[model samples]
Target: MEQPAATYPVHGPSLRKRRMALGLTVQEAADKAGISRSYLQRLETGIRERMGPKRYTRLRTALNATNDQISPPPEIPTEER
Candidate 1:
């Protein structure tokens, strides 16, 4: 049986907190992450969900967040197929 892929929900507040703690404005963080400011704002405000690893890595690096801090909520286990 094959298990389903893991999917974690984006933790918006934490992202915002980390960015602020680093004294980065939204534009600065977005530029560092190589994403648009609008998209970063959406992520910070919880308008977006389910960030893939590539984007997550960029954001994590930009915010200088540790693995634990950047980790999203764990995906619920599903029945194996």
Candidate 2:
């Protein structure tokens, strides 16, 4: 039998939704993603908006999330030095 495609929650555009969908606590998800809990929390709460490729890949891999299920990291503005 073909397995059904995984569907992550779309209630909100934050990592928290995906974490909650999988019934994983922040610490658990962070550990799985190989990141600090505070970093993950920042991403979930929109305290931070951009993620580097390494971090993004880690989160996606940890969550087993499809491209659509995860929000792409928005481009960060260059500092006006």
Candidate 3:
């Protein structure tokens, strides 16, 4: 039998950015994601790194994030702008 590919943790900053881009406050996002506001805040601030599959799914759906959108973009140097 073939094995499935592995998945990784969602990036915190990307989650925050996505949530903000969608115009959701932490409370709203948490409510939509079925998690606590404090938990969502922890995820955004990097106090938490990983979420279980259920919570992850809820959060991803709430944020409208595809797999490719979960990771944060590289920080560009000021001089590069």
lDDT against true structure, model 1: 0.81
lDDT of 1 by residue, 1-81 (tens): 985345445678888888898999999999999989998888878888667677777888889887678556678999998
Question: In candidate 1, how many clashes are counted?
Answer: 0
- For all candidates in order, the CA lDDT equals 0.81, 0.74, 0.83
lDDT of 2 at 71: 74
Clashes of 2: 0
- Residue 36 in model 2: shift from native, Å? 0.1
Cα error of candidate 3 at position 11, Å: 1.1
* Residue 51 error, candidate 1, Å: 1.0
> Residue 6 error for model 2, in Å?
28
Q: Estimate each model's TM-score.
A: 0.73, 0.69, 0.76
Off by over 4 Å in 1: 1-8, 72-81
Off by over 4 Å in 2: 1-12, 72-81
Better of 2 and 3 by TM-score: 3
TM-score of 3: 0.76
Query: How would the candidate models be sorted by TM-score, starting from the highest?
Result: 3, 1, 2
Per-residue lDDT of candidate 2, residues 1-81 (tens digit): 985334322212556778888999999999999999998887777667667667777888888886567774557999998
